[model samples]
Target chain A: MTDLSYTSPRSGSRTANILLRWALYIMLGLFALFYLMPLFVMVITSFKSLDEIRTGDLISLPREVTFDAWRTAWSGACTGIQCEGVRPFFWNSVLIAIPAVLISTLIGALNGYVVAQWRFKGANLFFALMLFGCFIPFQVVLLPMARMLGLMGMAGTIPGLIFVHVIYGLGFTTLFFRNYYVSIPSELTKAAKVDGAGFFRIFWSIFLPLSLPIIVVTVIWQFTQIWNDFLFGVSFSQAGTQPVTVALNNIVNSTTGVKAYNVDMAAAIIAALPTLFVYVVAGKYFVRGLTAGSVKG
Target chain B: MTKWLEEHMPKLVLAPSFIVVLIFVYGFIAWTAWVSLTRSRLLPRYEIDGFIQYDRLFASPRWDTAFTNLFVFGFLFIVIAMILGLILAILLDQNIRTEGAIRTIYLYPMALSMIVTGTAWKWILNPGLGLEATVRGWGFEDFTFNWLVDPDMAIYTVVIAAIWQSSGFVMALFLAGLRSVDQEIIKAAQVDGIPTWRVYTAIIIPAMAPIFLSAFIVLSHLAIKSFDLVIALTGGGPGYATDLPATYMYTMAFSRGDIGQAASSAMIMMMVVFTIVVPYLYSELRTKDD
Candidate 1:
């Protein structure tokens, strides 16, 4: 072929490749924009004054970028006679979430260790039973759980809600640690056994240290689940012991009044900030934990 | 081991948790199932009702809508989440810059509860407040994004919001699977001058089958019990377009004061979940057995 013709063909293919690349970029950009639109609206609405929210376009720049909504959502919004924002429930949420995380993950790690290392006869059965429990909707068990809590005299308290969180969280947390433990080499546990380490000792010193990755995951997962849990928090407890989700819900989920979009958005975002903060900070380990959890032993 | 246990410690160390789960979780489940079979209403009454509750539940139009909506919501959620997840996964796996930041952005929604995130999305999707107004303000006088208001389209809005919350986890799963792929395979494809897309489509995707299955199972389970998103989004409204089984069960038990029928609805949902979960368990066990 002539040199000029060869160059022409090469340039034509280069142009085609450039066109394809631009098309792909545009498509992906559009998808990302659509994915982010909801978040964009939430952030913008949170910044706008309530009057601006009423009068201006949702996409428009806020005439006044005020922290008033944030302040109100956090401190002044009222669900009932009390005008406290979700402030009280914030402490209640933290109280429930911390213990819920600690106890659940500790037990989960132990359960995972036992199931993965020492397969007792009914161990698989136990795991299977727990796994099945995960599928039962909370609605199915809510009444029974409530009745049981009432019988135990722990109803409508932080401890009662914590118990509910632990019960519901057992499945996922066990699965997380169980799967992670299975990924670990059995030889390590066997070596610990040979060194005269009993179950508790080996777990405390070796298994526990090695399980930082999965533990972080379990903690993060349980923290977020318990922190933001609404059904258990709302149903298991009275108004006084309700978590931030319920408090946030009462602020935004009002049925009889004209809904305040800006306040609602701010409140929702406020409720989510703790979990979102964890995700932003320790999100790396969380992602690692998720991948590790998904991998089959 | 049995003989050793008999000689030393008879009860296992894990017995406490096992019993807790059995009595509280499993035992309560049995109790609830029993309640479904009885004439319970407004509260748990221990009197047998035969199949009366089930019959009534099957006959109710609201129940029918709830069941239909679940199937529609479940199918659409799984499909869209898988597709979008795959696309994001593939993109992230392409040696992209700022991987950590992008990964965080994607997975943050999964960490928050559906009530919180769903409420946010509901506001953003609301016609009067969110997208519709936003589009109209952008020099589009006739812009009509009314899915939030339309009875038929409202559920799709929920699906859209749910997909946003879940597909990130799916992407993370695929990314993990991608990371585990043998580096030699990609090198071999490069040596053979195969295009990157062809290589990913032909070779890597097939190898990521197990991860895909795992993601599908998790997403499907979430879709089935997806009550909070429905509740916070539309409250199953514009006339019950987004009513799911779990939310329906809630309304039946609490709002309508039909505890038996609600329990029956929960039972049916259990059966549906069993159909999905039993096979998943079986396949997982079989794979382990092999």
Candidate 2:
């Protein structure tokens, strides 16, 4: 590459600095608009009644701001004889997502702690295998997974779904925790060991408290992943046991019915709200967690 | 015995996950690959029927369209996402006000499921209901922004939506890299009379090469496996103009009940990803370990 270093002859002037400042602002302002456009439309459309939305003027202020669409989307919208909207599935999602995050993160912490701290024989081998498995597309594994679940009599059940999510999440979750743990000085674990703290004991006491950042990251990642998962929920869930994403997908993604753009947008936003909330609130930790060892070996 | 037990307790704890992965994840993947070689449909069968499945997969026009579309979508998505991400990172590095808020705004979309983002983008791009109608209503009836409906342009619509959804993630990754750049080097460059843009292009960009590579890999992986966006947005519509390998494999298995062909297509998709990623992985392992 040519040396791109430029020697400036012009002095830093009062007018030039101000222009540069405003230019930066204008550029970012435009970018923010681009980012916010789809979301703005979704939020507005969610507040509009179906009649107003049919006018198809997406940019105009809704002639009527009715809570009816939100109500119907959440409660009365039709999804296969359960005219009840997103409530049941929402709760199911919570029920499933909470346990999945907790169990998976716990296991992940253990995996990370062991892999980083212990240097056991073939430990890297195990980690590599798990990582390779992660790269295989989930669609390829669907049928055999379903078959295995069926054989185990756990297919379409919460435990089965939980197992699926944990297994799938194991790679990234382990990667996150391992990288985070590696960053912590070994002296902590070593000192705990000198005090005769058992492996799990040191992890629980010495390491766990220091892991709040990664815990938040893991919780956010696993929560969003398990919560918003469509393929797994659709594949493994029966009607009564489905997550909100499935219900939302059925309602919003149905091919043949007169598609309600407003409800569809609302449902989409609703499906994403919990995860989005976590991102906005704890985005710092999330970004930090992802970036810890971003330049991977 | 006690010493041995002490030495092995940690690995023993790791056993459950390893076993779970083997039996459930990898075992299932292997099983699926095996099924691709057999003549099964809608469900797995033990009967081996030669290379018949692979032959059918090769013969299908849908498969060809899907492969081509993936390359087109993948190339556009990766290139555009990288440019947009790098630019956003550079701009954000200019000591902007409300750093935290802007970071949150940019990174927020990655938090949403592709399904939701796809749906929202679909509405925003709809010719009858969205931008076209709104623009024409502002008195330009001659305006032609109907890409969403145009069969030739539908995949590009997907590219637009995908860029909107993912460039923020790339921005976040690049920003992290930019922040880690040594401030002293930048100060030295300024003292030497190097322009700000040149400083970035020459010093910062090369310094951030590893992060860039990692981000490129991550985004490429995402682009290759893109399914939720396609499913939600166009449903690979306008007679398969936007069809991709992942979505094509899905429809083949579920809708068409061609398990053999679906598996073959799935195998090919996996091969494509593995070919790109494995070489990258090998190089990383070899060079980084040293």
Candidate 3:
């Protein structure tokens, strides 16, 4: 092992470095294409006419662009008895995600505030229990959850779905907020307490404002998760209230008619758009939330 | 009274969520175990029968296929994703000019749901509509890549889709781990005349063993719980060729109207998850305690 630093710097070494750099670039570039290919195919196929799509290769550019598929996918594509396309279901997802994200983030913030700042006798145990929720296979809970929903007479409803998402979502959201809040000095809360601020008062004035970053992480995470969830959306909600993912699945899996490849691709893109939009617009926080929630939590 | 109320407020604020977890997470697990022991169909019944449901579940060929597929899919998915993720991370760790853009491209897939991943891959792999047809149309008349419809090969298609969705996530984790490695250590290795690849192989990677374990734990659990991906991609079709445990449980619970079978399968899935996760949790918690 000759020390490069101790040896005279050589053009050969520099060339080897440059070559290695180029090799890395090329390999990374190829994988980038692999990652982007399905998306490219989805977008291009969505834009192509059915005939053009049939005629063209999977990776070929469409001869003529068309929004017919997008239009049908959004407004008129049939999903079983529903011929109203994915619009209603998309709204259903929006409806479910908003309250679920809000409620879960809020509760998670409070939970984090308590567990991190206002530790009690069983705080660590409670936090541990909540954290365990993050790892349980949702399948394990599905049967009983359905039964619980039925017992409560909230089965197959949007509210029921929201309840389910919020319930399961608390683990991750709480983890995010707790991890974030844990880094904040307890002196802030202690000072507020010294000034006679109660728990809610301190949370409202001190913790909440300081919580903007974690809230963003939690909201983005919860929104993306609840929005993209297919299992609960499919299992807990009926046809009229099914989320976009389930509708998209039904539309794609529909066997009654000829497979509408173009429409299906368009619908897939449409279903993916909200999360993708969040990823593009707030991708930094999205990734931060992901890394924070997983790596640290 | 004020002092008492103040002392109790945190617990009260935390009570609802705590109770929810108590019932939903822990209690439901118990209930599910109980249901597994009962002879229930379509709807649950309370009469406890012995291990009949487990016996039936073990006997069913669908369950066998589902268990086998779970192993195959989980093993391939975790290994491929980790390797791809490690490679991508190492490459990106080279201080490339386009690292951010390339990383975003790689990670954007993770933001999308498995349903979207499955649907896109299903179309891409569709025999008549996707890769095979397109290749044939390009005058590669001998070409055949119809795994989507090929019963024997359909499970691999699911693996491919799962890898696509998750590898980027794993990459992000490893990239973070790579970045957090001490620059001094690398410089020390370089000054010691260690080859660059050898330095990474011997020093940097070994230092990130925790990240590797964390990534493995996350990936394994995800692989175990995969449901939407299989549903959106194969629907466990070509006659139940790609039925992972999650989908198998869903079918038994919902479509097949066998509550006992569903509960037993669900319990088994939970056991699989517990086996993977509880040890990880134990280690994590023990470290935290220390």
Candidate 4:
């Protein structure tokens, strides 16, 4: 490449470089449209009236924009026996995701601290078992979990769902924190231990302060996961207790009435908004968390 | 007493989660395996009855369709997502001006739940209301893109949505891999007059083989566990034409009240996952230790 550049006059190579750059840009722009088209359709349809949506092509900008579908999707769209819409289910998701994220992150942090700092007998084995939890298909646990929920008398409830999320979430959360903490110097903990610091003391004073970045990653990952979950949301909870994902499914797939395409689109967007907001706000951290969680742990 | 307590606090702090995983993950697995061997129904009955459930599971037509669909969906989803992701990553690696914005657009779909993807695509694929109608409206008069309702092609609709949702994630992984390649080596290759495409094919791509493997492992597991996407898009319909194993297991367990069959199917799904995962885990852990 260098020889060619040196041998050739600068003008011809510059032209070739400009042509290549334009070609790359055009290709990327086309692919970008492919990725954005569904989202464009989703948003455009959501703001149209049902009649307008019916008459218009899928790709057309709405003739008239209205918030009617959004209003109905938020407050009045029927999901089975309930006419109250996805509002309650939205709150249900919030209730479930918050506690689950906090508990999972907290436990993950402590577990990561102990495993990374203490290095007890069988620590690696315990960590491995916990890590294995990350890959087990939720199907493998459904029957027994149902039974366990029944025996515990928490079946079909939000707390039961939280319990399930935390338990399942422990794997990735622990992995994130463990991997993060492992990169912290063991000498810090050693010094703390030498200063008459016990495990909790050293962790709280020393490790916890340094854990903010990982905590953010774990919280965001767990929140997005639990928020977007449908299998557990549908399986573990009944109609009244279902999460936003399940309720959105019920609304969109409900076959008894005239299919409200606009309302369905609105509901879908509503369901996706939280995670979208998180991504837009802290995209860097989210990508970092995703890659770190994926490639390493 | 204090020393003893301090000495034991780590274990004590770790005990709850350990116990939870032990029960919720491992113990439940054992329980599900046992239930598969039993004659459980809408309500679990603890009478251990041999391989009746497995035999029934093997004999069920629905299970067969579900398994076949899993193969098609899993294979197509993984391969297409990997290739597309690699291409997108390579394109982005050209250091184009809009790389960040383009990358973000590609990745945003991953943040949305599968249900959302399904619902959005369901609208776009709806024959009467979506692309078919719109295309026909454009004066073609005979344009039809109705795969969503076509029983034979319904499963591929799922593949489309799944790939759309995940390929960006694969691209991100590959982009990270691409960026980490030693630039000095690339410069040396360039100095030798190796073409840019040849540099990628001969040097960069081969060096990123581990990223490819990791992406494959991730995407395969995701494909196997796909449920919500199918549920939202097709609901395993035009009459169970698109049932993946995960959705099939859900139907048997919850809707059909056939816990025995559900357990058997679930066990089979786990075995599929284990076959892929265990070897990966073993190799990964061994390599880490070394």
Candidate 5:
């Protein structure tokens, strides 16, 4: 958020107007604090020792910043079910998310290309069918999907989770690509067709190259959705395959012995880092993805 | 063969995904619907048994609590988030310095998973140590803010965390909408000596009905599907007090071994979603043709 300062001109006497402007800034700042204070608290708390956490206040910066909590959170915190920490689960998430994101984005691009440029009979209807998948509660599919995964011998496996993600993610991915591809003139495709191009040829040579922006949006969208997922992670996954969100929940919510607040906070932050990194760096596209994914066409 | 393959290239390319959606999405939904109608216990029994599971679901007090919690959580979360989002957007719309920075701060939570948000809030509201202790330490002495454990208030804690996560995204939406409002109309209102607040209330806000609806749909859908947040924040506890339908369904099928009740609840959830979304999709598609 750059501060180029294009403050809309307001109508008031000088004293009143300046006061109002100050009040607005204060209010905005307060809200910003409200939004940001948790992340700040999480960071500071993650560094504090359990003694300091027990002794100090929530808003105070740690007296002695330590990485021990992070180490414990990353490698050895007991999550009731296991004591190896969220490291394995985090890797499980990475394993699930990378392939899921890639496959979903690739298929979504193709689906989008077909719907937008290579419209065949009933493509829009099929596209609409796919779009409808976006809104279906995963609960509705849980019973059968579990059964289906079990039948396929992929139940409680990383590939099953990936398959589930890719299947559900197709809607948003396809929507992104189709909407983007539609903005390009069809003449490009037609010209290529006249010059003896096949379906994958024009798509690979033209549409795929032209789809970088939408691809970024879709990848970020898919990555965040897959990485952050807990319902699917918990439902379909067994002991070793759960995602970090599930593992983080287990670590934080575990009722065993003395609660490790610092470790819990560190584990939470560790789970949050990837998505937080994406938001901070590519926030503009993240916002674009939200808007694109939300508005139905 | 080459000619046939060339002619069918587009269809060939699109076939797999089409089949996947057909079976995975549409097919599984039908399967769920079928399962919901059966008397399945620990495992699925495919034989039809009518709406007996629904009778069981509606009869259960836990489901009742979960159903009621959905409305309370959904209403408060959606309403407060939109109100706060609109206000933040309005403030940021003032061309203030640091608008970009404030906007970034506000929207950063959206990128995080609900689970992360839940965990952070869980820590923040950790009964004695987090908010209550911090506030009491400030010499308020009796300033009790233990919503995290109170069964009645646990849902509201979920609402608060939800608002924190989603309201920023709403702010972004409204900010975009505010920025897109016709400049000429605002200028004309200003030229006519209308106050800024009136220009907003009487014109700008009214023109954003579409945005409000979109936000409402998004927020409500999220509310209905809110399982992860509750799972992390309260674990739908203080013992099922924070349970929404999603969690209820999960508990019944996975933990409790009451697959019939789970399937039925899942159907009801889908029905709720369809009622909200079908109309919205209809309106959107109808308008798009023009």
Candidate 6:
């Protein structure tokens, strides 16, 4: 609360200063309104009836809010092949996100520990190679990966998507843990080493215990990334295996009759719910993960 | 045996991921490079035919539009987002009481998937029933906001949506950069009767150049890889008006079954990424203590 940089504006009278501060508050509030507009529109539209949507203003509260559209979006909205809503795809995303986050986080913690604490030739180079994975355009690997997935007999399946996510996600996850672990002094590992602790022993006893914060950050990052992914989901999965985002896209984009605006908005909010939930619940850690992933140590 | 095991264990644990990166990341890049040079079709042929695919890719008009859209989209999206983000960041750094609440509202868009963003913006920008209609109802009888369906202006609509999604992230980065500024130096400037705006222009903003570059790299990378948003927003619509290289490459490989063009376009995208990223990696790795 006590920011040392706090200073009032000079060169203005008392009334002028008051006016300036009010202007600043109004500007911030207006920007906030701009940022919140799409969300506000989405929520209001999602709760309206089709008649209300057609007959009323684009941005207003529903005449009488209805759960019918949400229910349809969750269970009856149609993609090309079926009208089964987002249930199957939502579960598909859940299946993909949980295991991918866990396995990637596990590998990242170990990889990060060794890269940060243990010294060896080619370690940083290896780490650099892995880190560069985060930056490669996923398009470059699409053809080869598609072929490879087919060759391995995992194409068009959930496991295939998980493998793809974990492979691609390793760079960010490892970077997260490695950055966190580097701040941990090597003396702890050495002190344990003198007491005859082996590599796995020291990591298990020491590093893993100290990794709670980064683990929370990494899990949130990976979960959000994997859950909200659309390109990989659309490219790699078949009809039933599609993630919620892809399913939602199909439902919205494949309209044949009168367009269901309410259903479309409701479907979007549903598809966006998981990451939105994670962000709301643990946003501080989420921001930390994003800033950490980009800003160099 | 125990001593030997202890010494090699770190490498042992890291072997699987290192090997995966070597094959899946580096090895596949090599494979894609070969495919780009081949006369591949539905199935990839292993033989190289010396950039025939690249020739075809450059020849295609869709690829040309996608390529041009990349620049138009990237330049507008990055510049506007930076200006807005920097403005908001500077404002928020004034020790405002509502900084946390405002930052959360601004940055929440970054958490939602691009597809979700596309859906929301698509609806709002729709001509028949969206902003145009809403304004018309309010008695501006001749207002028209039809950019969503207009091929010429569709790409700008994407730029607007893209800016909304990421400008707040740029704000977050800049806010962090602003907070790390030396309080003592700012106080010293204030003591010299340096006006607040002058202090920011001369000292604070210029010092945040690295953060600006960081934001630039992030924004450009997102702009380059943008697919989901465009697909959900415009579907490369009216014609092939809004295709970025990513969507164009997808259409080639999957929709049209021209793996050759897809592979070739992929190589160019990779090259663009390498150009931006290689120098960054070199500088970052060189300066690190490890």
Worst 10 residues of 6 chain B by lDDT: B281-290
- Which predicted model would earn the best DockQ? 6
The 10-residue segment of model 2 chain A with minimum total lDDT is A1-10
Listed per candidate, the RMSD to the true structure in angstroms reads 4.4, 2.8, 2.2, 2.2, 2.0, 1.4
Please give, for residues B1-290, the per-residue lDDT of candidate 5 as tens digits: 99999898778878999899999988888888888899899988899988899998889999999999999999999999999999888888887867778889999999898888998999899867898899989899989898888998899999999999999999999988887788778777776877677888988899888999999999999999999999988998998899999999999889999888888999999999999998998778668657
Q: How far off is residue B56 in model 6, in Å?
A: 1.2
Query: Tens digit of lDDT per residue, candidate 1, span B1-290?
Result: 85576323313667877888888877877888999989888878888778888988889888888999998999999998988888887766544445666667677778778887778877777788677887888888898888988988898988888998888888888877787877677667666766666667888889888888888777777887788788788888988877888888888876788889878888888888778778877777668757
- Candidate 6, residues A1-297, lDDT tens digits: the string is 113233534556777767877888899999999999999999999999999988888887899999898999999989887899988999999999999999999999999999999968988888999989999999999988998999999999999999999999999999999999999999999999999888888998898888899999999999999998998999999989999999999998996867898999999999998998999999999999988878978
TM-score of each: 0.91, 0.94, 0.97, 0.97, 0.97, 0.98
Greater DockQ among 2 and 4 belongs to 4
* DockQ scores of the candidates: 0.43, 0.53, 0.61, 0.61, 0.62, 0.68
Where in model 5 is the C-alpha error above 4 Å? Answer: A1-10
List candidate 2 segments past 4 Å from native.
A1-12, A187-191, A255-258, A292-294, B1-4, B47-50, B286-288
Q: What RMSD value applies to candidate 3?
A: 2.2
lDDT scores for all predictions? Answer: 0.78, 0.80, 0.89, 0.90, 0.89, 0.91
> Candidates ranked by lDDT, best first?
6, 4, 3, 5, 2, 1
Of the two candidates 2 and 4, the one with more favorable lDDT, higher being better, is 4
Off by over 4 Å in 3: A1-11
The 10 consecutive residues of candidate 3 chain B with the worst lDDT sum are: B188-197
CAPRI tier for the interface of model 5:
medium
Supply the TM-score for candidate 6: 0.98
Which whole-number lDDT from 0 to 100 does residue B185 have in model 6? Answer: 86
Worst 10-residue stretch by lDDT in candidate 3 chain A?
A: A1-10
Which stretches in model 6 have alpha-carbon errors above 4 Å?
A1-9
Q: Every prediction's TM-score for the first chain?
A: 0.89, 0.89, 0.94, 0.95, 0.95, 0.97
Q: Write the per-residue lDDT of candidate 2 for residues B3-40, one digit (tens) a residue.
A: 78766888898899899888777777787788888989
lDDT of 3 at B290: 75
